[model samples]
Target: MNLKKSYIAAIMVAALLLGGVGAYFGVQLAQSQDSTAQQGGNGGTFADLSEEEQQELIGSSQGNEKLAKVNKAFNLIKDSYLEDVEDSKLIEGAIQGMMDSLEDPYSVYMDQETVEEFNHSIESSFEGIGAEVSMVEGKVTVIAPIKDSPAEEAGLKPNDQILKVDGESVEGLDLYDAVSKIRGEQGSKVTLEINRPGVSDPLNIELTRDDIPLETVYSDTKEVNGKTAGIIEITSFSEGTAKRFDEELAKLEDKGIDGLVIDVRGNPGGLFTAVEDILKNFIPKDTPYVQIEDRNGEKSRYFSEIDEKKGYPINVLIDEGSASASEILAGAMKEAGDAELVGTTSFGKGTVQQAIPMGDGSTIKMTLFKWLTPEGNWIHEKGIDPTIEVKQPDYFYTNPLQVEEPLQLNQNNDQVKNAQIMLNGLGYEPGNKDGLYDQKTANAVKSFQSDNNLDSDGKIDEQTANKLQADIVEKIREGNNDKQKEKALEVLFQ
Candidate 1:
């Protein structure tokens, strides 16, 4: 019985050993199948890839490789983060990073809430404080307040540095952020602390918000060299500006005006089409006026249609404050040789933006096109150079006009004297060469204009000097109405 028990035990041990070996081989086969399936699904294993593929796996691809690195870092944070993170905030940050990459002062990413507020401002007439704003020298400056607005009523002037809005510092805020903060519901009271040049201390003013009544066109008649010149000051290119300009032009013509001085000073542009229509009134033929280049390397040309009133001599005046549509118009007129541009270099603003509507009530204002001059010059970074440059006087041109006779009028600091010298050469008696543009100089200018038969506004400019030289029949003066047609013809040809 003992021997039989021992043999049975040995057989049982062999069966157990065989079973253990089979189980081990089965596990090895299963693992092999799993690894092969993983390789097939992912296309290849990490060990099978080349050096380039290895770098790509870690996101080292060229052409936006920086963005790829950022994306990889974010993914790592998401996958291996110790604490849970909000995906929405991360997404928002990514959007902001995208905008920051563009490095544009005007281009920005608006959060959903801010975008909603912006939409409300455009669609409805809700307002907090009314002021046109811009970023000048990296500071938030008030361009101009709307006429009859709370800002104007509160004695807010143009070029006022808005230091604070409702006690919030405007230091770090961009143009759009500052604008958004200043704009709010109508009837809401807001306070502004400003820092002006002439003011001794910071000026604090409190105002209540109201509707911003649109005043697109401002016109007046200034008598120059005994002839009435229509002076139209346009602050913006709104929907009503073109129609208003047309009406103003008709009124000036009816009043027997000799020349037109369109002042587009301190004008920030609005709509592109409105300025195009305005340009058509002066340009006679269907000519290319401006070129638009997009992000995708696509381009488009905007043309000026022919006008019936091609007889008018239009002189456009621009300054450092003129931007966007203002620059576009100036460039177009100068290229067409239809008008003379006189003033300082214009503000460089070449990009065209479009407010793309979201499914929600909000919108995203994205710069889509870059504006180009007719001469194919990009006005971005580099501003428009004036054909004729004229600098303003340090002091006002008052009726009595007392010149601040500097102790010594050196050539280095006597621009007025230089102007007088130029005028004297142009056959205008500028009294004594005292290096001053005073009342005597103004009177002398009037006398010169009277003798030359031009407008008697006492303002010596390129147009007036050119007219005086062209007539050559100096001292044989004629009425403005009689000389208007001739001057217009001269300007048209020039």
Candidate 2:
């Protein structure tokens, strides 16, 4: 029994002895009161003893049979152990055991070295081979490569299972150990062997680590439906994101863009103020953008503050990769009828994480709050489903970072054909919607790029594919078919 319970039991026993001959009835009554008091802390009192007597009563349980096993274990460790050990280490081990018992992948106790590394990563940016890795399905999978980082330059992609690090087998290593292997001094090289989906052989990549600059907003423009559509991929709501997004907006305006596509895929999310500032550029002042609800049903509303709406009918692209602050952006746009969400449902991580610093410099990140849309819908486990569902094109470009389990190639791979078909339907006229890519298709692709202010290389990269796969064209088509584009605009502005 624990010390608290032992002390309480001792008091009860003492009270029973003090009452003497007629104490049986009183003892039963006191026991009932004690049980009720323990259940809910009802300010219970034991009036039968003085302060000194109470202390003595509690001390009587030190030699009780209930504590015999604990005492014996302590004696054996102190007297018969082969080596002398500190009591503090044993206590720390016990604490570690308690955390292990929870069986939660996210929650873990960090030792000194781990604690220091985690703290440094959060504060000062470090040099490393930049890839977000997670222990998923009993293997370390690449969530995504940081843009322009060593991993991205080496062509790492999401969902690539890492089989080896620096030629060392990673079969039994934990997530932390794998991360440690990947991180090192700048200019140092690390090699990763990846096992990816739909690839023939295990892909090997050697990357030189570098200090990665974490930017929040990335933008590019492309042509669709004979019109220039400016695409901005927002990775996080960092302090610089609003200014970066505004810069992109100005560039798009200068280029006379006709449409906008916002990519929020694989965006882990960040600061609320940054999100609000961003919403201001797209939404009208006084429009509800997001809401936070507490367990007590008290809600706070966050509204857009822009006086004028500047956003062209926007299309927000999402997938199982987008999360947190990204959801806030997508949820707000969808609720306000400002943007049409395309692609798969998001990552469904709606809860807010707060880092509480311990007396030591280490901090514990705990999920303290949850986020909601302006409509007051909780987005915890249930993510926001897109108005238009589109899958990420799997066959357009092979993942060079890792080779997946061999596919039964006899099955039809239709992603390229799907892209061609979708591109044709949008009107920027790529040649014939044939499954095979030819010279005519390449010419049309170049024309589209030159007109849209893109790199004009005619090569369909992942970013280009992301834009093509979005639902902007489909949403526009649906509006045209219903003959409601004009009417809907009137209602929306009104």
Candidate 3:
């Protein structure tokens, strides 16, 4: 039989099986008819097929035995089942089963409700706790909380393993189902039981869901040793992220910053278009940013068209939370020699998925291609390791109780000793690394705070301690055992 004839014959078999069920199935057949019309006279209508012709088509497609088995099963369920089943439910289940058989996690069937939620997510406004989560190691793990979001306010941290949602265990649950349990109408309360890395006991955090307004680009200027550097943090590449990034970079340029740091530390990737647009700012025109390779070995390259490159030393910070479009941007920048990547290995997710709308209001997100860097490296399942691997400070995993108490002038303990050591590491000159919060130590703290833009209170509060530890880690990462802000500044000055 001709290929077109065989294809139409297959659809006819499906329509005939579902036609007697409901009006929805009838509508589906009508849509198929419309498609057949568009295809022209490859084969005549179902009415034109004689009984022998129909049997022949069905036999060619599935053989008589397999088709008989399917028909028998359908009739058995419909006639002998204890409960009445809806035709829509059966059709949906069959579709889901087909998708499940592929065994690809990224490819799935989205019902109408799921489609709406997916659209809302891309639009960047949703009623939720405002955290990007994913299934990691068989648990729902928080990638990051959006800046100024309810999740951030509730103290949700990166790599937090969510054990329960609203008093119900989320173990073995789908990531989307867990997310649905956590998300609700605005002003609704949702409780999360979190198991952090160092904490022995699970911490239960209560948060009020709100309408999250996402801001993808956050930029500020920092003066290091009298040299200015622009620090831009991209949370996610939402709809307006590219424009926001350009505007922020322009402001930094107007300030005449000597260096730039692009921080995508906990950014779960968003739209590819946003990442492409941002690449145009720093990559020279005609430079290939990324390549997409399809199943048939056809490849397409996405290139940059910016007239000029930014004349500044660039550093990119990424962690395990950086994925998808974030990896694309990072890979492009590193391949183009436009920036040096810092931090740890990034989250590997190089596959591309396209959401295709069905005739109904549903959608099917199918993995269509795999992305590669400009240098032709496929970073899927294997993340991109940074040039400089800077591990997070040990203090990051410490219990909040250990660091929450403010160390004052009269306090002398292990916490104070730790702070003094960090301060001395950063060249704060706190006299001694002894466990003593003396007047000299207090004076050193005040001086350090004055230079670092913190309040000159001469007390080691939570914020002060956190900053001190971060500065110490940064100093070590810069290859300086005892200095603040040396590596990037040296590169910029050179």
Candidate 1 on 132-231: residue-level lDDT in tens?
A: 5656665777654444456654655556888998999999775667776776667888888887765445766677877754566766676655667676
lDDT of 2 by residue, 87-159 (tens): 7566445445544555433333445565566445644355787665655555777655555466755666666
List residue ranges in candidate 3 displaced over 4 A: 1-72, 118-124, 195-202, 399-494
- Model 3: residue 238 alpha-carbon error in angstroms: 1.3
Question: What is the clash count of model 2?
Answer: 3
Over 4 Å off, model 1: 1-87, 123-129, 135-163, 184-210, 223-226, 254-256, 295-299, 307-309, 358-362, 391-494
lDDT of 1 at 290: 69
Q: Which ten residues in a row have the lowest lDDT in candidate 1?
A: 1-10
As a whole number from 0 to 100, the lDDT of residue 43 in candidate 1 is 21
The model with the greater lDDT, 1 or 3, is 3
For candidate 1, what is the lDDT? 0.55
**Model 3, residue 31: what's the lDDT?**
27
Q: For all candidates, what are the clash counts? A: 10, 3, 0
